[model samples]
Target: MTVVEVLFLLLGLVAAGSALLVVTTRTMVHAALWLVVTLGAVAGIFLLLAAEFVAWVQILIYVGAVVVLLLFALMLTKAPTGPQPDLDARRALPAVAVAGLVLAVLGTTVVAGFHGVELDLDGAVVGSAQTTGATIFQQWVLPFEVLSVLLLAALVGAIVLSRGTGRRGGE
Candidate 1:
């Protein structure tokens, strides 16, 4: 097989495996770590698909910022530094059913959409760093600003919640 195909298969497996671990792992911290893996694999897949802008954003926003925030929250809340409680199969069954339904629908839609469509990306430009930066700054500036504002708000909210014990003195 071609190099691209091999890379795609590897990244796809990593994404899928980490996604499964994210759901299956009992420890919240382990789940977050697995989610980081999943997000990084997704970024790799985006890079392979020639969407460098999306790939970088995936790395910067999800793996870098979001996961860091998650870890911070875990630390602030003093989540068990050890393994989490075992999964309850009864409670998880419903979620599993819903996930299966959604996955089936998505799979059907993708298969139908790509039934006859063949991609020919031989001429498309795999965007450069400068060009991608210019496009985001010039065209997608509003969304970037919005994302930054949202992140700022989340940070402030987490700090507020963590500090609000509501006890003025020793009780």
Candidate 2:
């Protein structure tokens, strides 16, 4: 096939593998780090699709903010640094079955939707920053503001949780 197709396949493999690791890893910190890999792979796929704005946003929002937040929360909560023995392989079969089922559904839907269809990339500017920004501000402003508020609240909650109620020496 084409080089782009090969690259897309590679990125998809990376994303899928990392996503599996994110779910299976016993260490919380390692899982978060694996999530970063998964997100970075997705961003790379976005870039390969010529969606520059989406790629950058994926990197910034997911890899930068979300993963960092997860790591911070893990650290603040004093989570275990080693492999958790409690997390056994008992759910592996069920998890794999569910994943396979979802993948089958998605693949079927995609094939049906795009059957015999070809994309015309000429003069297409859907992924441009200007277009994305205008759409977000014009039609998605309320949701954007609500998400910002939610993030702010989560940040505050993390800080509060990290700082325990016990008084310090100065107090």
Candidate 3:
């Protein structure tokens, strides 16, 4: 087994474990923290695939900004910070079975698709930053602007929701 394979295996395990924690944790804050870990591990996986720009963006956008905002909202709302109830083994068993089936199908599809493909790691890593920046601004500027607007809307919504309803027009 190669070093890359080992890294991938370890990172994948971390990502999966954190993702499960995110869903299973009772406390909202702990779930958000687990989500951050999962997002960071995904960023590491992107870096291992020689996608530094994407990895940094994942960390900056998802782990840094989104999760922070989510936590802030949770705090503002005074969400319950208690231990979770026990997982229903009956529901969990079916859910796990479905998840496993989906994973198997996706894995089979990816492996079959890339069975004969050869990727050049050096080329993938070289000059990627400049090209990625240019591509994002040039090709995806519209979507980028739209996402900014969406974020602004989300922030406004959070603020509006946090405000109490007992407000007067002239106070």
Candidate 4:
């Protein structure tokens, strides 16, 4: 197809591979790092799709804040950073089967729904900041504010819990 399609496919592959790594990696820290890679790849895909606002938001919110929050929580908790045998031994077959089934159904639905529809990228409006801001502020104000408050609460709670634990494991 076009160059953009090729780049989109490549980015999609990168995102999918790293997302699998995020789940399958034995170490918690490594998983978080892989998630960063996956999110970055997704942002690249959004950029290629000409959604500049969304791409930057993905980079800022997910890659910057969420991943940093996860990493901070992991470090502060002193959780195992290495592979754990008991965790490794948990049954994965059922999960894999379920994931495969879901993928198959979704893929089929997408193909069926979009079989003949062609996108007109040349005629589409560029995703502008003013439009996006207006749309969000007008339609999604409550949800957006609620999400912000939730993230703030999570950050506060993590800090408070970390501060409360003493040297004797809070005994």
Best by lDDT: 2
Instruction: Identify the superior model by TM-score, candidate 2 or candidate 4.
Output: 4
User: Candidate 1: worst 10 consecutive residues by lDDT?
Assistant: 81-90
Kindly list the per-residue Cα lDDT of model 3 for residues 1-90, writing each as its tens digit: 678779989999999999999988877789999999999999998988888888988999998899998998888888777764753354
lDDT of 4 by residue, 1-171 (tens): 988889889999999999998888878899899999999999998777668899899999999999998999899889697786565547889999999999999999999999999865665666667778988899989999999999899989877877755654637
C-alpha TM-scores of all predictions: 0.80, 0.74, 0.73, 0.79
Off by over 4 Å in 1: 86-89, 142-171
Report RMSD (Å) for each prediction in the order shown.
Answer: 3.3, 3.9, 3.5, 3.8
Which pairs clash (backbone N, Cα, C closer than 3 Å) in model 4?
A: none
Clashing pairs in model 1, backbone N/Cα/C closer than 3 A: none
Model 2 per-residue lDDT tens digits across residues 71-164? 9889988998999977657667897899899999999999999999966545566577987899999999999999999989998997888787
Range of the 10 consecutive residues with the lowest summed lDDT in candidate 3: 119-128
Which stretches in model 4 have alpha-carbon errors above 4 Å? Answer: 138-171
State the lDDT of candidate 1 residue by residue for 21-139, as single tens digits. 99888888898899999999999989888888889988999999999989988888888867767644758879989999999999999999898896555667787688788988999
Scored by TM-score, the top model is 1
How many clashes show up per model? 0, 0, 0, 0
- Put the candidates in lDDT order, highest first: 2, 1, 4, 3
